[model samples]
Target: MASENMEISLPLELHPFVIRVLDDPDLQQRLASIVEAKAFVEESLKVAAEQEIPLNAEILASTLRPDPLGLGRFTSAPLQMDNWPPIGWLPTRTVQSQDGTPAFDWVWFGPHRHSRPFFEEDVRRAEAMPFNWLFRVRTGLQALISGYGSEPEVPLKGLIFHMSRCGSTLLSQMYASVPDSLVSSEPEPLGGVIQWIRLAKVDQESAITVMRAIVAALGRDSGTGAKYHLIKAEAWNAHSIALFRNAFPSVNWVFLYRNSIEVLVSLLRQPAIHTVENLMPREMVELNDEEPRSREEFAALVVAKIGKSIITHQHLGGGLVIAYPDIIDAATTSIP
Candidate 1:
């Protein structure tokens, strides 16, 4: 966070910095390595400063994340976490706080109407409020297990898996369209914890415990609804099917896939964060540290990797497979 007295102003010339920080691979790598949030901001300001790109804390802060649920006067009033309601706090990221214990940072996503492709577009907005940097809060890993605000009555309906550019979001949306159902597509905290688990940042028992906590939080039941809980994991998350299965054995699941040629065309036209180099860890997608022949080729391999993982795990008892063309029908008839 910039000093409160640092003249909260963003120069016109620095407007492009927002787009650059999120879209530029090198810039993301440079900032992501910083363990401390404040240090991260300071380094970001310096990057723009050294390049002679006019910038201020405000401008830089706005591009750090998605959803403007920060504790600004203009934003929603935040309820204290002491007895926090499940619906009020949205888990934003899984992080190890200054204490070195793994935890999750939460933000507000009120009843406000939101943009589509929630994680992709909303997170990409880089929408941040200065207040967020000043007073962010973290719910320790135990809160997830100690019984969050409240747990939904029903067990998870099913998990939604997909190759990106496929109809996973569409199907999840369809499920959300139904009355009393809550479909969270590409949950960031879940994705974040999965990465950390793979990186060995957390032990196995704790990882399983927190994952259950996360799902329970997402499945919060406020006494009346969300009888159906469906989470659409990221394309690369196919590799974690066993993790989810281990943590949620009885929960049903479905994997949606599409034609590779069409998937490649979609990526070539507009690359997703996972497909872009440095945006995501290569090891998460089974790629070696050596340079890929091409970004396009790398993306294809990533898509193939996800497909192979899906094939390897789709036979996990309750799991079902659905092709892109048959998604709507499959979701309608196949998902119970």
Candidate 2:
């Protein structure tokens, strides 16, 4: 066991709960075990980081350490085992198995473990994929379809896209302020599935199945009889518009565009921008350059792709496209 050279603290919100749990002798023992397990996982991560492992299959397998009980119960799973791909090269999960059966279910790093078969199933489906881009598209489509057959259903509000940053979060937060509107921040898990589909050349039937699972999960959090369920996706996911259009013809689209230089600048600063490694040469060419002729030129190119997507949606007879500047202006209006 590694010596504890530093003391770790829980958040203020959990301090009281921690104290209460510690006061009980049996609970204290359990808590101690959890702490020890966590420390072991953390130390393994530290070593992995120092060694500069990519947090992919090889590193994940190497970091899998056995628990005190010698049951392979304290080790972490491969990042590929996670529902979503790792952000950059960061280790994303620390799983455990008991008697060769997975003890800890797939969980994102957080307190609230919302256990639902749909979430887990979707994660498993996504793990089969090589990447997540198409997964997101399929998930959105499935969500749209589920709402159709669901009892007391609400219409989807809109699908928003942008060319990387450019205040999409601010816009999403503003939209979330509206009553009964369920807003999901950059839902990237689906993206992983999508990427996998493209890489693995999955059949349409398999893709559809994966898509349906994700949609059902998203629908689980929606308010009963709400007017809209807004999903904001990563910027490069422009291709998903066609999938959404085919699945839900009535949904609207809000296509956001910013200066290319600004978008590139923002992407470079952030560690998680989706790359164009899987795209065609022509498509990559458009995205390859860091500079644009002008903001309007960048906006035009954005609008063109969005327009193409909109046309496809329109051909399918569904969805609306609104500009980000226009949405910002309207959001600030005083009139009801």
Candidate 3:
């Protein structure tokens, strides 16, 4: 295809080529079949060159990635594109705009191939892929430019929230077992967007727009032609249940609660991040302050606030209150 001696014309941006590859069923299938990381990138580059997509190493290597030392990160060149296609990419985190506005840091995720217990875990794997390491990180208003007016390919059917040590993951796993389901458990990007809204980093209009847009982008169907999408939010996120309900008025949700003693004991054995004194803010769980509270006390208060918040907002949306026992019953009950 391209050679050192050949003077090939390269495009100003790489999103169009990436979109073409991801949107084409045959091209995506062939690329997805490559098990070797290097081979995947090589093949993708080859295909781009063959299609005269103006492929070049300078642009390919410019994709963002984590540095080996974990000190900071490797950066990508600024990409110039009008509107981004939602087929293959997803927002990884939230960033600040030059004008102090909130924005998303988009990344290449290829397509949804596997459903991990947590959506962030699936995204982490995608980020590590050699194919994805070639992603372009465009600056300024990528969210607004990408899928601004589009709806999710798959329909969001349910939202699962829970108290710590509950059966939320198991519930999501069951949904994931169904072949036509797209389930994202505790996605990081959703949390990021929520944080922006909570902090008023984005105005209400833009907040709703990005929040809806990100969920739609995540709901994109993989090759399985998945029809249903569900998200199991982080346990601490129960504090923001009202915000979520307001954002997705029609989406049904369930909050899974467990015995306080059981949840306390579980957290005592192994403390979750939210259980730590300063890790999560007191305002989040409705505590007066972080001081004077032991680990056990902190866990108890957080769980209580989470439950209270959920109960308060349960009337909104099509909210359902489900206990941990009910989750167990639904999961373990065998058909006669």
Best by lDDT: 3
In model 2, how large is the Cα lDDT of residue 244? Answer: 56
Return the TM-score for each candidate structure: 0.68, 0.46, 0.78
Model 3: how far residue 112 lies from native, Å: 3.0
- Candidate 2 per-residue lDDT, tens place, 18-74, comes to 233323433323222232334434543443355453233333233334322222213
Q: Between 1 and 2, whose TM-score is larger?
A: 1
Local accuracy of candidate 3 as per-residue lDDT tens digits, 172-217: 8888888888888887767766766666546666666777777876
Specify the poorest-scoring 10-residue window by lDDT in model 3. Answer: 1-10
TM-score (C-alpha, index-matched) for candidate 1:
0.68
Residue range with the least summed lDDT across 10 consecutive positions in model 1: 1-10
lDDT order, best first, reads 3, 1, 2
Candidate 2 global lDDT: 0.40
Task: Give the lDDT of residue 308 in candidate 1.
Answer: 89
Runs in model 2 deviating more than 4 A are 1-155, 221-227, 275-324, 330-336
